[model samples]
Target: MKEADRCCGSAGSFSIIHHDLSMKVLERKISNIVTAKAEVVATSCPTCTMQLSYGLKSHGLTGQVMHPVQLLAKSY
Candidate 1:
C-alpha cells in the first residue's frame, strides 16, 4: 500500500475510455499492493474495488478486495 492514496485507474469511465493507459496505472497500483503483501485491499470507491479485484485475479493472486464497510461488517 505504498501508494495507497494513488488512483486505481478506474476513475469513472476513464478506464473504459482509455483502457490501455488505465491498465498501466492500475499496474503500478497493483505492484504496490503486491509489494505490501496485502491480504485484503479496502477501498471506498466501487470502481477501485472492481479494478483491484480484477488486477489481483489477473496476477493470479487470491487476495480479497472489498469496501471498507463490507470489511467492517465482516469483522463483527
Candidate 2:
C-alpha cells in the first residue's frame, strides 16, 4: 500500500476548520495513491472516505474510493 492509501486529511472537524491545510494534505494523499498503483481505496470513516474520493476525482485518478464494507458487499 502506498502512503496515500494509509492517510486522510479530514481529521474530523479539523478538516472543516482548516480547509487550506486539509487540501494540501489531501493532495499528498492523492499522490501516494498514484504511486501505490491502487485500484480501490477503502476507508472506515465517512469523512476521510469523502476526502479520498474527492481528492481522486480532483486529481483525475480513476481509482475507486469506498468504504471497506461497501466494497465487500459489492463483491458478494
Candidate 3:
C-alpha cells in the first residue's frame, strides 16, 4: 500500500492526451484493488470515481464504487 495515494491516471486533460498510458496506469491501480480484496471503492474526485467503477467492471470485480459524500448522504 506504499503507493496507495498514487495517481490513477484520470488527470483531466492528461487522460485525454495519453489515453493508452492512462489506462495502463489505471490497470495497475485496479490490480491493487483486486489484491486487497476490497468490497467497495470510494473517492472524492468524480473522475477517479468513474475510473474505479470502470476498473472494477473491466477486471471482473463485483465491488461497489461510490463517492464518500454519497455514503454520508445515505447515512443521514
Candidate 4:
C-alpha cells in the first residue's frame, strides 16, 4: 500500500472538546505508524488528515501526509 491506515485521534468533536485525550490518542497512533516505517499517511477526512500531519510533525516523524484520493491521483 501507499501508507498505513491509522486513526489521527481526531474523533470528530472529541478533539475539539477534549484536547488532552485527543493528544493521547494521537500519540498512540503516531507511535504505531512510526513503528510501521510509513513513508506517508493517507486519510479520507480532512480534519483527520490535518491532525495526522500535525501529529507526525510533532513527533518528529519525516512522513508526509495526504488524502487517499490525492495519493491515487498521483499514482496514476
lDDT against the true structure, each candidate: 0.93, 0.84, 0.82, 0.81
Better of 2 and 3 by TM-score: 2
Q: Of the pair 2 and 4, which is ahead by lDDT?
A: 2
Residue range 1-76, candidate 1, lDDT tens digits = 6989999999989999999999999999989999999999999998998998999999999899988899999999
Per-residue lDDT of candidate 2, residues 1-76 (tens digit): 6564454789888889999999988888887788889889888888987888889888888999888899999999
Off by over 4 Å in 3: 73-76
**Candidate 4 local lDDT, residue 64:** 85
Clashing residue pairs in candidate 1 (N, C-alpha, C atoms within 3 angstroms): none
Query: What clash pairs does model 3 have?
Result: none
- Leading candidate by TM-score: 1
Q: For each candidate, C-alpha RMSD in Å?
A: 0.8, 1.7, 1.8, 2.8
- For candidate 2, the per-residue lDDT at 24 reads 88
Ten residues in sequence with the least summed lDDT for candidate 2: 1-10
Give the poorly placed runs of model 4, Cα more than 4 Å off.
1-6
